[model samples]
Target: MQPMSRKTQYFTDSVIRRMTRISLDCGAINLAQGFPDFDPPQAMLDRLAEVSHLGPHQYPITMGAPNFRQALARKCGRFMGLELDPDTNIVVTIGSTEAMVDTIFALTNPGDKIVMFSPYFENYHAQALFADCQPIYVPLVPPKFNFDANVLEEAFKQHPKAILICNPSNPSGKVFTYEELKLIADLCIKYDVYAIMDEVYEHIVYAPHKHTYMATLPGMWERTVSCSSLSKTYSITGWRLGYAIAPKPIMDKIKQYHDFNTVGAPAPLMEAAVVGLEMPDSYYEEFGAHYAHMKQLFTDGLRRIGIPFTDPQGAYFVLANIGPYMKKGQTDVEFCEEMARKVGVACVPGTSFFMEDVRDIVRVHFAKKDETLLEALNRLEDIKAKMA
Candidate 1:
């Protein structure tokens, strides 16, 4: 037999998906994958059926469906304050997954260095490898998940080809504030580097904190490549609809690569997303309220069980420190597996987020029903009893 490509051997299966599978096998409440079990907006559902009859089933434009791009331009303009030329600057993608991979391949030359925060979305490392680029990891330390300014500046001084920023970040659920994003923008401007932002959780933010668009900052529009999806925003992960908002030149390069990547995102799905992109401002407000309610419900559950955790300011994930309960020399994978198999509550181990020594924290998702969260909490009450 011939050998597999080196690229194919570099990565492992997604730890998050595997955890979700284990949860299913145990019939556990899955707080592992960050997907909501709820339905998308009623209007989007209606539009999907409407588009099904409209005959876009074959193939739309190679870049994107026209109506979808126009709606996206309008929506992004309203929120990010950028006048986007849909034809020149937006390239619809299968998901932010494809967007990230495409953008990295487009912008990074072989051996180019890309700065990515540790505990980032796991695919990023593989994307760097696929792009034939080097990744310089900067750690986002826990609890608040703050980064040191000096550390960021030092990485910028290396003149990296690009930096990947995930706002309302996954795993820890830390939303980057305007000030933090400003510092990043300044560094990018000074270093003449690209800023690739993953803002898929843009509308799922909680109270007091807002989702800041990296491209909206002064001088950042030209340097920023923004990737986002309808997956998290509308709870329609299976739709595989996402897009990149960047300068014409960057989008041009990205489109050439994406044209052959998936050829085009699903045609009918893009037609249906027009309705989602045009949803009212109140939809976002109510969306935030819904996420806030879930966050409170989950946090309250953790508190009742005497588990210490970081309260999420934006996204739907919670990272709880489980270090205090390790009496029989348990590893993170062991702990999480036992938690799922024995207690019927599944979560992702923090070790999957970083390459460092700390795996004492477990990442949980709050994007579930109240009854579901309550049931998970009830299961967690037995944690102390299981401790040695």
Candidate 2:
């Protein structure tokens, strides 16, 4: 038989998911995958229960269920400050994972170049490769996770087809500010490139650091394809309901790809998630407050344990430097497995998220309940002795 597609050789299975499995095997507290251990909003749960018994169990429209799309348009338009037409601007997808990949397929041809920052979500690299596109990586300097404008302009000089921006970035937890975003928008306009935004953590941003929708920037409304999901905001990751909003022209292509891809997001789940989309502004305020509490709880414990880590402005993940605990010549991957087994805590190795030669940093999330985080911190207190 012929060998499998060469694209499969470019990347390994998801290290984030691998660490989750290792955590399960060792009975460790899982800080590897970024999912909350608590229940979703009670209202959504109740609505889901009702939807299960009442209909729409089969398939909805290929674009999306009408009520879901309308709710999404109203909610997103209010926040994004844009008038979105449910019929023309939205394509519900099977999570932002599919939303992103479908947007890539719709926007670029094979061998096109895409710009992305280092220490990005692991899925972006794989998505680019799967689409037969090359990624031009621009590093976000550590401690602050800021990128140099000159460096970014240099990548844009390569005339890449699109640039993927993950606001409230994963693995590093840096939230891009408005001035920073304006710099990118200016460059995108100058270079005539598309901006594919992964804004899944839009509502989870910390205070003093706001999420600026890329499409909201002047001259960007036409060129930006915004992809997000109900997973993080609603704490319903298992629901797998996500959507992309773009101009009608771009969305027509994305809708075509989505139609042939998954046919549509789960019908009953879409019907149920409408409650989440229709939630009031106060709901998001409380949601952000809850995450702020979790962030404070986990980071304060790390400080008490004398572990140095990057204090995130947004997103729940933190990059902790465990260089002091690493054995001589030990890779982050090996250290992570050993830590999982011996210390009863799990985290993703930093190498999984970086393009540069980086080790000694492990990414862990604080999205769990307070008890779970406290337990993980308690186990981590003796990490130096146990790993040494």
Candidate 3:
């Protein structure tokens, strides 16, 4: 029999999705995946219904439907602080996942170095491996998830071809500040490297902590490829609508990679989501307020139950310390499974998010509805007895 591709040997299945399977098998309430339990905005749903009957169920151009690109260009321009040429600057992909995948393969060559913060989203590591790229991990130390400037600068000295970062980061929930973004931007410029940013949580930021587009920084516009999605902002994860915004030359290569891969996002979903892209600033204000309320509600519950968690400044995830729950020599995976079967809730073991040895933590999320979060919290109240 012919052996399979060697690249498959570099990684395992996603622990995030793996935990959802454990939840189903154990009859546990799932908190592993990050989608919201609530439905998308009523207006968007109504728009979707209307658009479904209209035409163009087939692929809209390979780049994107004309209307979708224009809407996205306007939205991006608001933060980029410059008018973006939709025709030349944006390429819509299946989702931010594809956006990153396309950009990585488009810009990087085999054995080129890709620098990323440790404890990153699991998919980024796999993408680098699949591209035949070598990943250089810089630790974003826990409890605060802040990186030392010297340490980061030293990493840039390795001559990496690109640096991948997620603002309002997944798993960690650390939002990079303007100062930090500037540091990264300056380093990218100094090193002549590309900055591939994940800005999917752009609209869901918490108060006093804003999301600044790295591309807006001086000297960064041409070097930054911003990959974002409507999935988080518009609550349309299943819709698979996302885009990569960059300067003309980079986007041309990205377009080729994107077209060769998935071609483009679903036309109907793209049409429906333009309504969200065109939403007023007040809608985003309310959007942040809603996520703020959910974060408070979930973390407040964890506090009352006497569990320790790193409170997030942005994004919907919380990395809670589950170290105390594990018996001697037990793995994070074992503890997560026990937590699911006994306590009736499931989470991803922290080991999956790291490049180094990691345990004593697990990722939970508050992206669900208030009632759903409350129910999960209620089950979590007996953690001591159940986990024992």
- Give the Cα-based TM-score of candidate 2 against the true structure: 0.99
lDDT of 2 at 326: 96
lDDT (tens digit, per residue) of candidate 1 on 165-185: 889898778899999999989
The model with the greater TM-score, 2 or 3, is 2
User: Per-residue lDDT of 290-349 in model 2, one digit per residue for the tens?
Assistant: 999999999999999999999998889999999999999999999999999999999999
TM-score of each: 0.96, 0.99, 0.98
* Full-model lDDT for every candidate: 0.88, 0.94, 0.91
- Model 3, 1-388: lDDT tens digits are 9998999888999888988888889888889889898888888999999988995699689999999999999988986688899999999999999999999999999999999998899999999998999999999987889998998889899999999999989989999999999999999999999999999988877878888899889999989999998899888899988899999999999999988899778888888888888899888888888999999999999999998999887889999998878899999988998899999999999988987788888999999989999999999998988888
Worst-scoring 10-residue span by lDDT in model 3: 202-211
User: Best TM-score goes to which candidate?
Assistant: 2
Model 2 / residue 199 / CA error / Å: 0.4
Candidate 2 RMSD to the real structure:
0.7
Worst 10 residues of 1 by lDDT: 379-388
